[model samples]
Target chain A: MIIGEQKPFEEIWEMVKGHKQLTVFGCNTCVAVCHQGGNKEAEIMASLLRMRATQEGLEIDIKNGGIERQCEHPFFESAKALLDQSEAVLSLACGIGVQFVAEKYMNTPVYPALNTTFLGDVKQDGFFTEKCQACGDCVLGVTGGVCPVSRCCKRLFNGPCGGSSNGKCEISKDIDCAWQLVVDRLQALGKMDDYEKLVPIKDWSKDRAGGPRSFKLEDF
Target chain B: MAIDAEKIEQPKSPEKVRDVPADWKANIIAFACHYCAFAAADLAGVMRLSYPSNVKVVRLPCTGKLDQIYLLRAFERGVDGVFAAG
Candidate 1:
């Protein structure tokens, strides 16, 4: 899932204080799972902004609302009324959602309340860890389901580096050695023979180096 | 006698702190859990112990029920200080 964190309240206030009418819009998908950009969080943000406005003697009309997903147009159908009336929108979605909203409303100003972090997995309640770099190449099949692109600090493909000690990466004790994990996984699956097969140099053209990527359904 | 809905007095919204005069006292809100804090406050009242009149106690099922939004809402509505007691 896409993980994001809300920007500082002071910074958010600085960006939105000038507006007379504002709406705090949230995306109730990926970012919501992290307790950052959700409808409930948007309401809290609106309340904080309102309190700040009141304290500063500013007369800004602020409202909060959200939809299931902000990246799609169909989900926005229900939010037309609130969004149409807004002078400026403080979006509590990821970068994609913010840009999508900006594109949909050409004339109105849209501001992001969150900083898009990474594609990650929820390690535990309230804890998220990055899992994928979206390198546009699948190595997990041969790597025993471990992602060297993301898990390995150096993105090593062949085997563990000299820094691997006691199954921990040299970069941090908390991080597991990606290759060690791969070897262990392969050993468990009786696929250690595949370890001898060396992987060639990666072709990163399929990644960000080739510029923006897109996919379409040819069947459609 | 049947109660008249129209005759009932509607509660007015709180005045903004910024709008208040210079000599105005702070308006503090206390969220009290019914299991302990609320009962303690009630006991205090029974004992005729004097407390700050500016403090308004709101009863909750539990202090765990308190949300961050509730605290911000208090400030948004011009409250000076707020505390949650379990």
Candidate 2:
């Protein structure tokens, strides 16, 4: 699920006031799962926006369009008819969805109503941390499942640096040393030999250098 | 040709009347996908399960197609809230 923050009501008011017609969009995928801009959120925002418009003495027309995901083309197409009537759109999806809407709806002005937050894992209620950098190359085997790229402050693949102290990283006393954690896990699993196998220098070109990449498989 | 001039400029205004209670009329709009939420609401109606009378639901083929502007417009037109499903 995508984590996002709602835009200030005052800021949203400014955008809708200038336009005679507007559309408020919602995505039910990531943002919805995170409880930001889903069907329920769409209704709430629309209700509040309308009230605010009335209070401001503005003759604005706002509509709501909740789709599965704004980033996907097939889903964005669902909004085509609504775009016909509106001069502007206030998207409640993540940054990508906002851009996708603008990219698809050429004549209609698209505005982001939510700030996209980081890509992280929800470890527990109300707590989360980054677990992967999406560096393109995955090397979890040697690290015994503990991702140094994510857990390590230095992203060191070799030995733990001088920062490794008391089984914690020098960056923070509370954070466990990534290498130490890796070693302990490997030892527990009797797989320390996996680390003994030397890994060659990482190819930076292989990591995101090729730009945003994807592979489409017609068949699974 | 259709009517022109003053005809196009005509206004629609109702005659003033005495104040009357409206039972706190609220205009709630629901942008429901035809697949799920709409069906559930339909079932709600079929069962005669009464909810807040203010809600007005509009069904769509899919929630994916709703333009964000429509939602904002509902509120602009004094709608209370909206809901969707896909």
Candidate 3:
């Protein structure tokens, strides 16, 4: 899921304090899982903003609202009234959701309440780790389900780099060497033979190198 | 019966704004766990022990059930400080 972190309160206040009527909108999907930008979080943010406004002697009217998914148009129907009445919107969604809201409400100023972090997985309760870079090409099948592109600091294709030491990356002891995980998984699965085969150079064009990309389903 | 939104009373603006008055007191919110802190508070009450009058105690099922939004809401409602006791 796309992970995001809320911006600092001071910075967020600086951005939206000028607006008299504001809406703190949240996306209850990926960001919600992280306990950052969900509707519950949006309520907290709105409350904080209200407190700050009271302290600053500002008479701002702020409301909190959210939807299941901000990136999709259908989910926004429920929030249409709240959003339409907003003079400015503080979007607590990923960058995509913020842009989507901004695009939909062209006249109203939309501000991002979160810093879009990365495509990651919930490693544990209240813990998340990056799992994919969305390089547009997947190589997980041959790599024992471990992604070398994102996990490996060097993105080495064939095997562990010389810097790999005791399953840890050379950069940090906290980071697990991606190749080491792949090798260990392969050994456990008795597929070590596949590791010996040489992998060709990855096509850079398939990734961000190709520039802004899009996908469409013809059947739809 | 239907209610009228226009009849809702508006909040009065703060007279001091950002300035703190000499008579101002810290309003603290304490989230006490049912099994631990709440029990301790109950014992303290039974023993006639005194705590700060400003510290309002909110009993929770467990400290683990305390959410961040609760603390934020406490502050938003103009509480000076808040803590969870488990």
Tens-digit per-residue lDDT, B2-35, candidate 3: 3344334356544564877998889999999999
lDDT of 2 at A214: 80
Residue pairs of candidate 1 with colliding backbone atoms: none
Question: What are the candidates' C-alpha RMSDs?
Answer: 11.0, 13.4, 9.3
Kindly list the per-residue Cα lDDT of model 2 for residues A74-129, writing each as its tens digit: 87577678766778888889998989888887878988888787666777765656
User: DockQ score of candidate 1?
Assistant: 0.23
As a TM-score, model 2 comes out at 0.63
* All candidates in order of lDDT, best leading: 1, 3, 2
- Show the colliding residue pairs in model 3: none
Residue B45 in model 3: shift from native, Å? Answer: 7.4
Q: Considering just chain B, what TM-score does every model have?
A: 0.71, 0.61, 0.74
lDDT of 1 by residue, A63-180 (tens): 9999999999999999999999999999999999999999999999999999898999999999999889999998999999999999999999999999999999999999999999
Compare candidates 2 and 3 on TM-score and give the better one.
3
TM-score top scorer: 1
In candidate 3, stretches whose alpha carbon ends up further than 4 angstroms from where it belongs are B1-65, B81-86
Q: What is the lDDT of residue A170 in candidate 2?
A: 88
For lDDT, the strongest prediction is 1
